[model samples]
Target: MNHWLMKTEPDELGIDDFAHEPQRDFMWDGVRNYQARNFMRSMQPGDHVVLYHSSCKHIGTAGIVKVTRAAYADPEQFNPDSAYYDPKSSATEPRWDAVDLCFVDKFPRIIPLSELKTLSALADCALVRKGNRLSVMPLSANEYKAILATTNR
Candidate 1:
């Protein structure tokens, strides 16, 4: 299965939120970036994902989640009240897509971004590269393995 990394603010929707409701399918939505949206569209059910927490005090890879559903139109884009809503988007022709992710595991401790940058396996990863802010990005098998290895699991 393919591997990927998706970033989210801990306060918005983080590892803990998924851990609390492990069985629920969490809709990963509100991605406004075209590249990020394309990445989501490429995901398939059963693919693994790295759950990264950013824009918070402790920024890092917090846990593992797996795609439980493939990409579909983002419901938030149709809601006028949602901050992610787009008037140009229509139900028949969606401009954004979202996927469903289910919790897999929560790391004992966060694997900090500083440490990730030092890993040779992730040296070329967009996540570790400077100025790369796309929320959803693909991960090489080596990079995924290396990140999980840091958890000692």
Candidate 2:
């Protein structure tokens, strides 16, 4: 299975939301960026994901999640009342996709972005790369493990 990192505003669906209802499969959606949407479409069941909290006072890697279902057309994209609705999309042709992810772990404390930037193993990671802002990003095994290792420190 592949590894991925997805960023979310804490107020939206953050890691705590997963921890609160660990058994529920949350639909990860509302990704408007083409690159991020493509990455979501590439995810498969059992893939691991790093949950990053952004646009908040304590921006950092919050925890881990596992993909329980692969990509499917995002239902919000067809609902005009939904914030993620796409006027150009239709039932026959979807312009966005979403995956199902369930909680895996929530770190005792957030791994701050400052700390993540210092890890040599993540030097090539887009999450730490300067100005690289795709909400959904791929991660190498080494990179994934490196981030998880930080939880013990």
RMSD of each: 1.0, 0.8
Residues 48-126, candidate 1: write the lDDT tens digits. Answer: 9999999999999999999999999999999999999999999999999989999999999999999999899999899
Q: State, as a TM-score between 0 and 1, how close model 1 is to the true structure.
A: 0.98
- Candidate 1, residue 142: how far the Cα is off, in Å: 0.7
Per-residue lDDT for 30-126 in model 2, tens only?
Answer: 8899999888889999999999999998999999999999999999999999999999998999999989999999998999999999999999898
Q: List lDDT for all candidates, in order.
A: 0.95, 0.94
Model 1 worst lDDT window (10 residues) = 144-153
Root-mean-square deviation of candidate 1: 1.0
Q: Cα lDDT of model 1 overall?
A: 0.95
The candidate scoring highest on lDDT is 1
Number of backbone clashes in candidate 2: 0
